[model samples]
Target: MMIRIRSRDGLERVSVDNPAATVAELKFAIESQLRVPVHAQILSTNQNLLLAKAPGDLNKFTDMLDPNARVSALGISHGSIVFLAYEGERTVAGPAFHPSGSFGKKMTMDDLIAKQMRITRQENPHCELVSFDRDAANAFQHYVNESLAFAVKRGGFMYGTVSEEGKVEVDFIYEPPQQGTEDNLILLRDPEEEKFVEAIALGLQMRKVGFIFTQTISQDKKDYTMSNAEVLQAVELHAEGDLKEWVTAVVKLEVNEDGGADVHFEAFQMSDMCVRLFKEGWFETEVKGEIDPKLSRMKKDVVVGGKDVTSVDNDFFLVVVKIFDHQGPLATTFPVENRRIPVSPGALRSHLDRSRNLPFVKRISDFHLLLFLSKYLDVNSDVPALSGCVRAQATVPEGYQLLIESMASAC
Candidate 1:
């Protein structure tokens, strides 16, 4: 039997030869196969506890205490996913330095000091301000507010362009496949979905400009606006885009003193210094247990006021620039990925019947609807054919339109 294991390092699979293996035996298998020390490993089926641990409680689950308890009896079976949290660091036996490597021929005290120097504040942002297209912002917020109800986290990529005055105008959003929870967001990207997004961007003359996410209302009670893990995740995404004008936007429900929930939006761009530190491996990547508020602090200047910040003085954010609003092309009438939309069998049939007069690509303007249609469409022919319509912004052929509409109506 194979079990999937997820940790901070990412997902892995481990084989448990014996169906009747005990919990202790499973621990040993993980230690041997995954290189995590048995004593240091804290395994659980609950993913929330994998990252967010309560104060003073080291081991939350008592299942592993009984070494002789069979894993199957404990409800762990083949193909199940388990979460692993470990203490201390795994020691790797390796040479101290490779003589031919970059760090091997180390030099003077000046060189060492240069590497250890702290990242300082920058004076300006590459993006002056990030302006969310009103429709796009409303579309994203509507999903989080109406569907998710501020319970779990949800995230997506911003697609648009930066203006001459350094304002980033986000025209649309493309949410990659992901798993969201109160404390974590794991992106599971689909290549086909990405191709579709690229086609949309190509048609609109936009690019992947920024990232946006929703913070659960539970976080409003916490001290920091963004947790260390959240900061790390946002920075990692920002770094991946490799765009100077990249923005990181967060939407959360803030409780006013009167106990009413107000939807709040904040935006920031990772400072050049912050990006450099991340690229150079200066920021700590391994975050576990309770996050220290100071861990996310850095001396970086941002554009909101453009002052040299010594630390994160406010709960707003560490790298806040500012926010603006605009109007975009897409309508917020249809549902998006990761958002729940109440669709009835009757409504679907009605929509299909109504769309009979229009082309297939135009019939389903929503990406989520397209995703639903993709399951029934042939991957080699129908999928790429429809995707081409998006890429070229061309009219959908009548045959393809009829097929997709029929499939959608049937569903």
Candidate 2:
């Protein structure tokens, strides 16, 4: 008989009969499954994100002498609301709403794991999200070596399996990937797309901008109105090649503070907005933006000769310009910042290699930055090398400027 374990994503059955299996063993197993490392996990019963914890007893942390670890609330109904238990902060059981704000809906598998990430900060320390998927009960049995490979490379393993009860959960040692390894988070930016999403959000914000997200824009003002057709038109136009005048100016959104974040956009500014988005890494970001004054007119991306071309606009909504111009004048390089695992230099070199620009580094900014950097540095760094001098800092390199957490770190 195997020892049954419940994790954040689900539950699992470990084969080790000895309840005294080291925490290190459990961590290793968790790491292999979840892709988190052994060191980044904590043993806290609190649920706080963006904060650090006092270190645990290394021996206790590394050893799994206590077989019955309260890792998670697996084997339960999967719901949109997460029941978060906090110790130092709230010290009570409260509802944790899903980031998407959809209540009582089943999240995608990715969202399900991401949900744990928030709770992982405080409630569940021994958990992580990995890049692979397998039969809930047999991921470990199938990908043990692969899990170890990720453990050695990107970070630690983040794997999990379901219990005999069939709940969706994950288990892993919360090893944070190495800091500053893969750091470049992307954003989504298509004038039409942005307009549609923004319009929907605006509708939500004012009870006047509403097509999706269920949150209605609180404003009942007749001055503001949005419809799916008008929104779709702008997107269609962008997909075609009609509007292309780029306006790269910083539109301030507020005052009483000297910060540069009060940014908003209109359809006329969509071209530059799109550029800003591309620079920010919204290669394939889902369409999101308020409805243009004329959304029904927007077009979808035009594909000619098997290539894609898009138009830009401004009337879509407000485009708050952040970084007008910088010295490097490069677009974003790394899409998101990722942490690495603990491994000697050579053990995971191959894993790191995959992240490198394949087939001569695409991304218009990389091309320009490499050229720009080369003009100041060397030529060889242009093609298959990471120029030591030039870094394609994103226009919005950090996550969201207006928001507390910008995708910048993740980007």
Candidate 3:
């Protein structure tokens, strides 16, 4: 049986001859075949738990523990993709180089010049600038400000299209299912919601072009604008998207000298060199000391615009685009993803009754709350019925309203 193992270096496959091998045997196979030591190998079914020394201790679903337990019993089977987080460096066994042969010849002037050319940073971005739709930005920020109070982290995908002039316009935000803390955010995507978002993007003639995230206010004391973990996350997303114009935007509250907090928006795109290095596994995943912001910066001299490499720091970040806002096509609603909205069915009804002056669609304009209700409603009937009401700006039927209220009360 062959299983795919994914690590920072990318994916590889190893054959497990025994169908019911013990966890200890699996570790030995990885060490022998993959060259990752058993002591350093941290395996898990969940990507979020890949770094856990013993994932089972954090999640009941994780079974990569107990040296003697059968790998098959732990849900590892043929063709499965197991995530791996390992420490230390791995040595590859390959043919030795011979200077006498052309294949292993010493470097020449041309070789050095080509190497310099290949490793240079890309100065211009594919997209000129990224502009956020005012309504979309406001809708997302209002929820985070009012509910989350900027105490923790939050992230979402930006959906839009690039103009002919290379301008990227973000018109909507889709907040996936996630768990976030002050310094970390774990995306737990919902397949159903993703499908719905894809459909919406298709209708809007847009694509997922960027990622937006919030930095907790506590991080302001730090020197760097983006943390090491944040850099890792952004690079991974940028690489995964494979979009030349992919944007990474950060939203944070900067403290003024007067002690007032002002919201700041910063946008960046990972340089082409950064993406290539990440894919080539040039980065050291396990750092022994504090992360150096300059570690990823270019040390070699490469002339760009008549300036040496020192003129443009190789900090994995390229041009910073100016952000502008415009009207967009979405509204905020209840049950925001990742953040709990405290509302009972009674409370919902009370609010609706109090807002009788407003239209029905306006009263229930919280799309996040509608998504939560989607889980309980009949997909073929109730879900579409409610979606239609919102789309057409029509009043929801009394029966559907009663059903949602009852479901909310049951919760």
Candidate with top lDDT is 1
Candidate order (TM-score): 1, 3, 2
Give per-model TM-scores.
0.59, 0.16, 0.57
Task: Kindly give the stretch of ten consecutive residues in candidate 2 with the minimal lDDT sum.
Answer: 206-215
TM-score of 2: 0.16
The predicted structure with the larger lDDT, 2 or 3, is: 3
Worst ten-residue run, lDDT, model 3? Answer: 95-104
lDDT of 3 by residue, 287-391 (tens): 334546434433344445434352233343555666777765446534355457544545455545556687766666545556556666666566666766765
CA lDDT, candidate 2, residue 20: 46
Q: Find the candidate with the highest TM-score and give its number.
A: 1
**Candidate 3 Cα misplacement greater than 4 A, ranges:** 1-121, 142-151, 203-205, 287-289, 297-316, 341-366, 376-411
Clashing pairs in 1: none
Q: Give one digit per residue, the lDDT tens place, for model 2 in 40-82.
A: 5443222232122343322233222343542233221211121
RMSD of each: 22.2, 27.7, 20.0
Ranking of candidates on lDDT, top first: 1, 3, 2
